[model samples]
Target: MITKDVRNWLGALTFLISLCLSGCQSGNAPASSPIETNRSLAPQRVDIRGSILSSQYSDGQVILEVERLSPSPDSRYDRAYVLVLPTAQMVDSEGLSVSISELRPGQNVAILLRAGGQGNRTGIGVARKLWIEDRF
Candidate 1:
C-alpha cells in the first residue's frame, strides 16, 4: 500500500515535470534544421550611446537610434535601431533611482542591455536590463 508520504512525493514530482514541459512550448514552429535548434543561451551585454529616437512608456518599450556602437553577432536584430524594455529592476545610469518617465526622446544617453530571447520563434534581441543616463 502507498504511504501518505509517498503519495505527496509523487504529486510534487508530477508538478515539477509539468513546469519543465511548459517551458518547452513557446508556441512557435519547430526549428527547420538541427543547426537552427542549437542556439547559445548565454546572455550578452551591449552598451549603446546615442539619442533616443522615440519613447513609449504606455507600451512599455523604447526605441533608440545608435550613433556609436559595436556590432552584434546576432544577425536577427538591427544594430542601428535598438528596442529597450523596462524591467522591474531597471534603473538609471547612477543605479540609485528607478524611474521610467525620466526617459525622453532626443535625449543623448547611454544604455546597457542584457540580451536574451533567441531561437524561441522571437529571434529579436530582448533587453533584460537598462541603465539610462541622467537626461530627461
Candidate 2:
C-alpha cells in the first residue's frame, strides 16, 4: 500500500536510525552533549616534588607553592606552583589515609601532574596525583 515517494522516505529514516544505533553500540564514543570549548585538550603528564612553601585551598581546589627540593638538571622551576583538585588522593608517611586540609606549609611532598597544559602566567602545571611525604 506504500507509494514510491513514501517508501523512499522510510528507507532514508531507517538508514539514519541504523547509523545512530551502530554508534551507540560501539560504546566508546561519548554521546552528544555540551562540551567545554574554552579548555584546551589534556596535556602530557609530569612529576614534581618539593617542600611545601605555601598551600591554598578554596572551593575544593588547591594551589600549592612547592620549592623543589631537588630539580632535574634542566628544571625550569626551582620553585613551582602546582594545582591540585579535591579528587586527588592523599596519604601520610605511613601510607595511611590523610586529608588535603592537613597539608601545611614546610611539609615535604611529591606531586604527579597528569594532562596539565604548558604553563603561561597561571603556573607550572595542574596535578592529577599528589602524595604527602613523611615530614619526620
Candidate 3:
C-alpha cells in the first residue's frame, strides 16, 4: 500500500507529464512555415526612427527589416524578413529562423513591442512579439 505522501507525489508527476505532452503539439510544425489561417487579427502600425530602433530595446529582441509583407487570411499582415539590424535574435529561446512572412525589407520591423497583441504601452512582448513598421 502507498503512503499519502506517495499519492501526492504521483499526482504532481501526472500533472507535469500532462503539461509536457501538451507542449509537443507545436513540434509537429517547423518554425519556417507560413501560418495560413482565417483567424481575425487587427495589426496596428507604428513608425519609429530607424537610427534609434535597435538601441532602445533589450536583448532577445531585435529591430528586423521588412523583406516582404503579405496578406494572410488570418492576420491582417504577414511580414517576412529581408534584413535584421544589429543581429537576429531568437524569441523565447526558440533559435528557429525568423520566417520570411514574419518581416519585410527597407522598413524597420520592430523597435517598440506590445504585450500580447501590440497595443499596450507598458507591456513588452519580448518573448512573443514582432515589431514592424510599413510606412516610411
Candidate 4:
C-alpha cells in the first residue's frame, strides 16, 4: 500500500521521463548538423568574371563569354552564357547605376547569376547583378 505522497511523486516522475523521451525523439537535426547546412536547400548563386560578347537592350539580354573567375573553373562554364537582364541591377566601373543599353561588346564585366536549374543546360541564367569592369 503506497502512501498518497509517494504515488503523487511517482506520477510526476513518470510524466517528466515521458516528456524528456518525447523531446529527444522529435526527429529534428541539431543546428550545426550537416543536414541543416545542405546547399541544395538554399538558392544557388554563381559569380563570373567575363567579357560581354554582345547585348540587345530591346530584347533585354546579354551574351557573355565566361572567363571562369570564381567557384573554381569547370568545363560547363567554358561556353557563353546568355543572361536575361530585364530585372538585373547593372552598374558601371564607377559604381553608378546603368542600363543594359549602356553595355558594350568587348567590355570586361563581373556578373552575379542565379542558376536556372539542373535541366537548364543551354547556359541561360537570370542576371541578378552586372558590373561593367571597363570604362568607356
Candidate 5:
C-alpha cells in the first residue's frame, strides 16, 4: 500500500523514464541513405547514356530525368544524377561539390547515374563527360 505522496513520486519517475526512452528513439531517426536499396550497383558501376530532357538540384545532387531517345524505336525515360561517389553524396567533378544548375537543360550529356531506388532515381552521379556521346 503506497501513500499518496509516494504514488505521485512513482508516477513522476515513470513519466521521466518514458520521456527519456522516447527522446532516444526520436534522436536515432534514420536519414536518407542512398545505398540501402535493392540496386547496390549504384555509384559503383553506373554507365548511363542519355539526353537530358530536364535537370534540377535536390538534396545536393543533379536530378536529371533524361530520354533514351535514340537506341529505341520509341523513347523511354531514365532518371540520373551527378554526385560524389562512395559517400553516396552529391558532389561535383574535381571531387568538389556541384548543383543541378551546372548541368543546364538543353545540354546533351552522358553521366554515370547510379541506379536509384524504387523511385527510379539515381544514387550519386559523376558528370564524366558532357556533349560527347553523340548518338547522332
Candidate 6:
C-alpha cells in the first residue's frame, strides 16, 4: 500500500501534468503569424518635429505636416500625420502644461510617437508626448 506522502506526491504530479497539457493545447484559438506576433509585442517609437496644420479640440486630434528636420529612416517625407492626443502629455514653449485647445495652426511642435497599427509608414501615430516649440 502507498504511504500518505506518496499518495499526495502522485496527486500533485498528476495535477501538474494536466496543467502542462492544457497549456500546450491552443484550443479553438487561431495561431498568430510571426510578424503579427512581433508587431503586437513591440511598438516602435518615433520622434518628429513639425508644424500643426490643424487641430480638433473636441476630438483631441492634431494634423501635423512634417518639415523633415532631422528625419529618421522610418520618417515619411512631406506627410501629414493625424495624431491621437487625448492621453498625450502636452507642454508649451515655457514647459508649462498646456491643453489641446491651446494648440493652433502654424505652431511648431516636437512630438514623441508610439507607432503602431499601420506603423509610421501610413502617417498614423499615437502621440505619447508633445512639446509646443517656439521655433523649429
lDDT (Cα, tens digit) per residue for candidate 2, span 16-131:
99999998888876665332331212112235556888889888877898876764542335666887777776665455666778889988776665654356323477766666
Better of 2 and 4 by lDDT: 2
Cα lDDT tens digits, model 3, 1-136, are 5788899999999999999988998767786533223111213432222212222233533434232234323232233212233343422112244533344334343332233323222222322333433343
Q: For all candidates, what are the clash counts?
A: 0, 0, 14, 0, 2, 0
Candidate 2 worst ten-residue window by lDDT: 35-44
lDDT of each: 0.51, 0.65, 0.36, 0.58, 0.47, 0.61
Q: Per-residue error at 62 for model 1, in Å?
A: 3.2
Error of 4 at 82 (Å): 2.6
Q: Which residue pairs show backbone clashes in model 5? A: 83-125, 84-91
Sort by TM-score, best first: 2, 6, 4, 1, 5, 3
Better of 3 and 4 by TM-score: 4
What value of lDDT does candidate 3 attain over all alpha carbons?
0.36
Off by over 4 Å in 5: 1-46, 72-100, 115-135
Ranking by lDDT: 2, 6, 4, 1, 5, 3
Q: What is candidate 1's TM-score against the reference?
A: 0.39
Instruction: State in Å the error of residue 126, model 6.
Output: 1.2
Q: Candidate 2, 100: how far from true, in Å?
A: 1.6
Q: What is the alpha-carbon lDDT for the whole of candidate 1?
A: 0.51
Quote the positional error of residue 75 for candidate 6 in Å: 6.2
Best by TM-score: 2
Candidate 3 lDDT for residue 127: 27
Candidate 1 at residue 122, lDDT? Answer: 23
In angstroms, give how far residue 72 of model 4 lies from its true place. Answer: 6.6
